[model samples]
Target: MGKLRWNILGIRGNPLATRPGMVKIQEKNVMLRKCWKTLLIGILFTLTLLIAGCWDRKEIENRGYVLGVGIDHVVSSGPKGLYDLDKTPQAAGQRKYKLTIEMPKFNKQEASKEVNKGQNHLIWSGEGESMFAITRMISTKTYFSPFFEDIQILVFSEAVAREGVGDILDFFLRDAEMRRLTRVFVTPGRAEDILKAKLQVEEVNSTFIGKLTANTDKAPYFAGKAELGQIAQALRSNHSFIVPIIVTEDKEVRLLKGAIFNKDHKMVGEMNELEILGGKILRQTLKQGIVVAPNPADPQHTVAFEIYEKKMNIDTSVQDDQILFTVKVILIGNLGENMVHEQDAVDPVFTKAVEKEIAAEVTRSIKAAFSKQQQLKADVTELGDLVHRQHPDYWKNVQDRWDEEVFPMAQLNVDVKIQIRRPVITH
Candidate 1:
């Protein structure tokens, strides 16, 4: 006070000097600020941890992966009719569908290797009019959630197919969980029997059956795979389509026939092995198959020509409201096997003879398919679609009566040519 040196504040002595009490106060302020910053950072970290997780995440084991579904009609209300449904609130005549779902038996140890017989899958059955209710009913029977996202196939009995698949297919088409690529089939026997059948190839029957559709490239007898998505599209477009028929005998499952449907959305008829082969040829979907022909040298033995390449050309014309389809089939293949040991497949003359016979066989198959489809008045070969695509204006006129009236009377001319490229190394 005696010196009266002015500080920056103009209230104290030395401006450069700091007081001990003031130093303590500044240190306390710094420490308090650091504490506040640390507290704020800690709160932010805690909040991040609280919100950083999937609230509705479901583990794989908790999901019931429905691999296949079999739909059958309840023919009666007897013991075999659907199930003892006295417990559920099912309306009269509403219990129309028998829903069967197949799930893979998930055993981590056995999953790596193939399990013989039906040990690979589990089956559950329920009957109800509403597919939603039937599926919901399945939930009460299992601990895991029924997930249809992984479903591989849907099988309908022949009876159900005849009754009409539209009702059963409606749920699958509208469901968000169902995949479009799921294979569809019609079986003459019980649909449930197909799922229950024993297997030798893979762990799951549904997966194996789904894989079987891929064999269309190898087997011409197949009517090509009828996927659910394709069926849905056909239904919406009012287009007649084919559903491959699956048959089981002695626990052996086979896909050798195809069920044809008219524009009426019901099964009209079926195509046999030969007819299906021809249909594939007409559709230009014949990829690879063995076309066996009677050898000229030895009528008792047959010459097998393996089709590796094929091209089909169709010319459509409408005259006086009559549709005439002319199909030119060109087949390129190798001599797969020659049962006639005397005849050399390498000889040009022999090769030509074989080619001629193969062409005749192909012609016969095509004609058979065309005639059968015409007789049944079913346009399952997409002939109507062809008209719609090639001559839209003409199709608009005949679109309504195309399948029933026009297609049945339509004339088909088939021309087949075969070329044998090579022969198997063996005799």
Candidate 2:
């Protein structure tokens, strides 16, 4: 019937019991936590609206995928290569460029309902003072917006290439949608005709041409793949480069030679198929090519050696203001054909003789290509790069004149060694 005893600190028997104003403080803390939870939920809900979906996304079906582009200079307005311009503000001799683009024709029907049958691409063209302007003008004619991200090839007419590709490529280099890996080519005639030419292997002519460039390893005649980025880099560095050449005849297009360009990005000349074969071997490396040499036994007949693997090294040195480049090439392949009926493949002497003949033939081809380069005064083989890397101090003195003067006067020595592994045919 008595009250419990308390400690000196005003604590009861239960030490954990709440004191007088603690109830109000606990109530205030609970209220604060609830407010914070509600505020956090509101912030999360607002953030969800901001990131609900892609704001700048475009539907794939509505985008026109541009696969190929061609450029040609408008020379005349009369009967041939007629260009229709209502009014002109420029001078008399000022030139305009024509642009052509190839895009896939979207097939919406089922397989059984297909009508066009083997027609899967369409070509659209326009003309303007600049490529960017031309591209914008072309967009207006298309139902879907032209997308350049998938562009596979760019072809320029000989006239346009001769005038200088720097101006035309400026737009492609600067555009965010354009890809740097797009292949580049030069055609002797109208580039639009190349795009319009029919192809039996591929549905799209642009794709076929692009694939053809990839066969440089198999075919020595090919100029190899010249990419947009590589050309841009060459132009930026003021170095000479080469673009593959193509010709269209009887509704068929054929990749033939290489259009050589000088330091100014102007087409100076072209490299023939044989010259390309040698250049590829000397400058880079060739995977396949035929080497024809006069047979030792029979002077009239010839022997063919097929190149399967090749490796090369080019070194440069400067002495008394004279530059000398030494190129060493090692080629290993099989005996493709032997017209000499007397020579036997089983004999080591015969194989050695054949190897020597093949080496001489390779040397001659390379020298011929080097001679052509000297004649044009264009260093398409990237010889300047060798000097810059090997002899930097000397390169600085003649860097400006490397392509025009120094490279032409430079002496080149090509040393080739050949090995015939598998002789398929004897005699």
Report every candidate's CA lDDT.
0.85, 0.81
lDDT of 2 by residue, 1-427 (tens): 1333343233445343366565556578779999999999999999998889888777776788999999987656675345655643433334488899988766644322432343557789877677777777778887786789999999999998999888778999999999999999999999888887665543577777777776677777678889999998998898888889989876567788999998888999999887887788666757676777887667598888888787788888788899988889988888888887667766888888889987887788788788888899888888788788988898889998887788789898889898888975544
Candidate 1 residues 190-265, lDDT tens each?
Answer: 8988898986666578988898888777888776899999999889988888999998877678887999987678
Judge candidate 2 at residue 340 and give its lDDT. 70
What TM-scores do the predictions have?
A: 0.84, 0.82
Q: Pick the TM-score winner.
A: 1
Candidate 1 has which clashing residue pairs, if any? none
